[model samples]
Every structure is written in C-alpha cells, then in structure tokens.
Target: MTAELDTPILDNHLHLDPDHGRGIDAVEDFARAGGTHLLVVNKPSWMLEDVGDDEAVFRAVFETTIDAVERASEVLPGRAWPVLGVHPALISKLTGRGYTPPEARDIMQAGLDVAAEYVADGPALALKSGRPHYDVGDPIWEASNDVMKHAFELGAETGSAVQLHTESGQDFTEVAEWAEERGLPAKRVVKHYSEGRLDGPTASVLADRDELEIAAEEAEPFLMETDFIDDPDRPGAVLGPKTVPRRVEWMREEGYDDAIRTAHVETPAAVYGIDLEATL
Candidate 1:
C-alpha cells in the first residue's frame, strides 16, 4: 500500500484515559481523521486516585490494566490494541506506601493472567517503563534491568512484543544491555519515540540505530511513534498532530525510505503484531 492511500497507518504509542478527556472514541476520531491505526496504551495507576494501601493500590492498578484492554478491545475492535504496565515512579511511590517489590510483581502477574483471558493466544504485549537518570551500577538501575528481563521473559513466553520507553541515554544503554544479557529477541523490544525536548534527540538517535540494525541483521521490526501529547499552550503540540507526515518527509529527505516506512507504518504493525497484510 502506498502512503497516500486511506489505508491504516499504525500508531505505535498512545496514552488513553477516559477520565482524562480522551478515550477510545477520541483516539478513533484522531486516527480516522489521519487515516491511521491506533495502538492505545493504558497505565494501571491512571485509574487510581486515592489508593490507600500498597496492596490495594496494586490490585486497583492491575485490574485497571486488564479492564482497559478488555474495554478497548470491545469498543474499538480492529482499530485498537492494549499495552499495560506500571511506570517506575508509580512503582516507587507504591513502595513508599509500603508495597514490597514482590507484592508489585505478583500484582503484575495477576494482571497478565487477566490479559491472557481476554486476548487470543500469542497476543502482542507492550511494557511501559522508563529508565531513570542514575548510575548504571546503582541498585535501582539493577532493579530496572531485572524488571526489563522479566518483561522480556513474559513476552517471549506469550509471543508478545515488548515496548519500552527509556527516559535518558543511560536508560537506552541499560535496555540494550538487558536485552543482550538474556538474548531477548529484537522483535520483542519495540522502542518508542516521544516528542519532548529530551525524547526528540534521543529518538532520532535510536531511529538511526534501528536503521543500522535493519541494514545489518534484517531482523524484526523496530517501532517508532509520534508520541505527541496535545496541549494548547505548547508550541510542540502542532508538531504532535503533524508528527507522522513530518517524520515521513524528514526520512525521505535523509534518503532513509526504509526507516520512514517503518516509523510511519510498518513498525507499528509489527509492534502490535497486527496482520496489516490481510487487512490492507
């Protein structure tokens, strides 16, 4: 399919919160307007407001993730897919509230169990966690590595794609190291590109790596995203809506058609494990 067709353009990263003024319908409208495919992401804690105990909070978050996916699947059908995870800061906050790491892990497992019930066998799964700016040798970094390894294991076992949101250059290195250590399949790790001050440059660099890897290994797809958050007050917001087209042109200018196609279309389908071939 050509780029000009009203064919589906895959959206690699999207955050949806019904309570936050945008939900499935809003995302659908946006995608329909742009003629794109929408992959909706729902974080567990976004549903919780004043969760009291750590265990209770964990339960709430876990249920929210499952419920979000289940609801989205019903509401959006072929247009939407779900990604679930706990942000690192949220996990830390839960810990401060007396939730142990083991407890948190159990909660995540419970959510996965629920997810398996809803999605078909071998459904694509995405993880939403950030790498913090800290020393690689730090205990927290080690802990992050453990979490990513566990995520990879979960994806490999379920045949799900693992998507990561790394905050700093350090986070990228850490994820690469984690993937290398466990022999994580490149297809399982889909890195996101957000449109923020830090993320833009970092994403550009990552996209370059993705191109080089694709040239060398002809491996599984590496995902890219507009990752735009709309805010009337921000100058970058315009770029948010225009992200896909702009990036496509940018890639064309750079003589990176493969990267452009992957960023705007192909990688998204691969990341969500969608069968666009049949649909298009």
Candidate 2:
C-alpha cells in the first residue's frame, strides 16, 4: 500500500535482537510494510549475557547493533544506521551491584565515551541516553542527568545526534537546555517515544494515529518511530516495526503528503545530518 508513495519511511528507534529474536527477518518485515530506513539502536548492557563492571562491556552491545544495522540495511530502501550508548536504566543495574549513584553515573559516561568513539570511527550515526522512565530518588536522578549531559558532550564532540528515552508527560525544555549548553544543538536531540509535542527537543513521535494527527496539526516537522524492541518473548511490546510505514501509508491516503515529506525526509536528514534522498 505504501510502495506507491516515494516518500521515505524512517523508524527513528528500533532494536534487533539476533540472539533471541527474529533478527534480520524483522527488518524484512519492516521492508514488506514499506519502511525505508531505521536507526537500529543498541539494547541495554544488561540484555547481554555478561553485564560486566567495566565500561568496555558496552562495546559488545554496540558491536551487536552495528552487525544488526549492516544486516538490516540490506533490506531497507533507504538505510539503517547504528545508535549506540549505555541505556540510562543501567544505573539501576549498577547500583544493584553495589555501586553508588555517582559511581554508576561515571560508568555510564565512560560507556558513552565508547559509543562516541564508535560514532566518530564510523559505525554509528548517533548516541542514545536518558534517565530512567520510572521514579527514583534524588541522587540517582541527579546522577542520571549527569550521564545524559555527558552524552550531549559526546554528541557535540563527535558531531552526532543524540536520542533520548526519558519519562513522559512534560516538556523537555530542560533537556534541550542541557544539549545547547554542551554545544550540541537542541534540534539534534531527539525525544524518542514522544507524543507529538513540539515544546521540547526534536520529537520522534510514536507512530499512533492520534499522535501523528497532533504532530501534523502542529505543522512542525518531526520524525516517527516504533521503538520496537524485537523481543520474541514480548512480541510487539512497544510497537511493531511496520508501525511507521503503515502509519505513513495511512497519512498518504489521508492527504498528509506534506507531513509525510517533512517527517520521513526533511526532519531525519536535518537531525542526523544524512542525505536520505541521496542515499536512496
């Protein structure tokens, strides 16, 4: 249904778990649904078999994402880029293992440094960082913010975009402030799993009809994503990989061609500094 439209359908955040899930077949599913591009982000370090104490543990996670992106790109119409970093939830894991809040934050920052190296060395296009979505005490929360700030610094140094996964319901103006203060443009910071609000950093609105309508009504360019975890056990726990392209097909049928172009073409290119049209 979506193939008739030449517009790109880029999923802003996706995870491909080759070891325990559909792996590249998931990418094929997205392709069949008319998805053109993806940002295959790294899963959390704890998802790996070994959640080691050292910051180097994240390297394996990033490498797995890189491999997944390489495989998915083969099936995508546009491209699949890697987005690597230590998941903000890692602080909880570290603290559970007897590390203090500040220590965990330092470890997360170091892990992001590794991710930044991958971006600079050409395996990844962006960095992912955010505080835990659930509530926590003041110290842990503050520490998580520091870790996110370090990610912003890395983004500034490496010239890569940053994707965030914070708790929902409020404007992310504070996050935007942090990004700008670290020398990374607020526009380059994407709020993944967003609800189509423009009162924050760049939005990667979830591919829901109501949310897409809100974003389209705003007439502001924003990216779309499914946040598909690709977990076989929890099938479609977030949204399915096909969600974005299917939503795009719906948008086109509804005569939202301008929104389609803005989201799938212009906004992604602007945020990631990639030429989606040229890549195609």
Candidate 3:
C-alpha cells in the first residue's frame, strides 16, 4: 500500500521516455502511489530506436517528450513534466554509422539549443546533460566534458536548473565550477544519484531505509528518486513509481517527518521554481 502522506513526495528524477518505455498510465500509477510530480528525462541514447542520424531529428525527441508528458498530464493534471537534452552516455548511439567527433558535437549542440528554447519557452521545467557514463577514459571524458560544458552554458543562460547524471562518486565540484564559470550559479544544480555533497543538492535512487537516513544526515534538503525505468523486463529496475511513498512511510516509522517534508516537498518546490507542496 502507498503511504498516505499529507504532502505527496515529488520524485526528482526518472526515465519515462515516451517510446523507449513506460505505459500510458505511468503518471497515474505514480500519483496513486503518492508521487505528486516527476522530472521525466528522455534518454535518447541511440539511433536504433528510430531517431535516425540527423541532428534535427534527434533534437525533435525533446519536443516529442513535451507532447508525451502533456498527454500523460491529461490523466493526471500537472503531475508530469520534462527534462530533455543530450545524455553523454548516448553519444556513441547518436553518432551512428558515420560517427565523427565534430559531427556529433555539432549535433549535440543543436540538441542543447532546442533544450534551451523549450526550457525558456516551452513546458520543459529544466535540462539534463551529463557524461555518457563514468570515466569513459580521458580522451572520451575530455570530449564529453566539452560537450557537457555547452549544456552548462545553456542552463546558465536559460536560468534552468541542470540535473546532472555523471558516474557515482565522481567529484562534481568541477561540474558545478563549470556552470559557475559559465555564469550559472552552482546552487542551480542537482546531482543525480549522489552519495555526498559536491556543490549542489543531490538526489538518491534505490537507497534503502537505512541508506536514506544516512543520506539525509549527510546532506540537508536533498531529493529522492526511483529512477523508475518503466521497462517490463526489468520491472521496477531501480525502484518502482511507488518507491517514494514507500520510503516516506519508512521515514515516518523512524519519526523523520521533517526529512520527508523537506526532501519530498519544500526542497523540490524551490528547486523546480514551481508549486509542489502539500497538494493533498
């Protein structure tokens, strides 16, 4: 049973790409399970998914995400939003048969341009960009880092908070510094799947009850996530859509209502620059 909290916890991050995965009723399941809002990122990691090799075509996925989330929101009003951009892990996939560094970089920049426009002009609440995966060796890391820096510039220019997805345990201070150097405030960042502080707030995925407690103690006003892949084969891969509410129940059992209220409610509201508090 989903915990009946007066204030529904908002999942800071999750991957519910329209075509990559997730059912039509994904938003409803999250809502019924006590999730009030989610930042669904479209991990457009490959061309095999019918995206083709064109940069414009790849960037169109962000627009499609807006449409998809809108459709979901019809079933659960204002419950779903998008966080779209180039994920570094998807670089190789985006490259396709004619993989070239310069070509891929230009294509990614195009995607970031689209992301910035949506973030400022469309319903996209934020942007997500990161190295394709952890330390893909120095050569790969340097190139990806340069591409990600452009993303940071977009985040800074558009005043959109960037949700980072680098490898776990990597010092994100440099990531934050990159944004800050580009004129974006470091605080306007959310480190996804973080274990400790880097320079901004962090969010957790699949942490157990005890782990969650330790995380909260380590960082005040952080966030929680399920990273719910919504894939049938790996159903509830990290945690299900209902994960946050279940964790909230655990916190309550341990008498940690304050932590729940902050991470699940107030903090998200402030970070996303929208109202997500106590809609219950």
The candidate scoring highest on lDDT is: 2
Q: Which is the winner by lDDT between candidate 1 and candidate 3?
A: 3
- Which ranges in model 3 have alpha carbons more than 4 Å from their true place? 18-20, 45-48, 51-53, 94-96, 196-201, 204-207, 278-280
Using TM-score as the measure, the top candidate is: 2
Sort by lDDT, best first: 2, 3, 1
How much is 99 displaced in model 2, in angstroms?
0.4
Per-residue lDDT tens digits for candidate 1, residues 1-280, read 1134333445566555555434455444544334344455554463454432344554455455445545555533244556655454444544567767555444444444444333334233555544443344354455555565666666655666566655543235445556545655554465555322221112321323334344324322444454544323342332243345444444455566665555445655554556643444
Q: What is the C-alpha local distance difference test score of candidate 3?
A: 0.70
Q: After superposition, how far is residue 164 of candidate 2 from its true place, in Å?
A: 0.4
Better of 2 and 3 by TM-score: 2
Candidate scoring better on lDDT of 1 and 2: 2
lDDT of 2 by residue, 7-86 (tens): 77788998999998879988998998888889998887777645545755787888888988998898788789999988
Q: Can you write out model 3's per-residue Cα lDDT over 1-280, one digit (the tens) per residue?
A: 7667477667777776566467556677877776666778765645224443455665567667777777766765347779877777666654555666556666677777778888999789888877765445565567677777888899878888888777776367777788889977776678777663434434543446766787667546677887777676687777777777678877888888788877767667667776765333
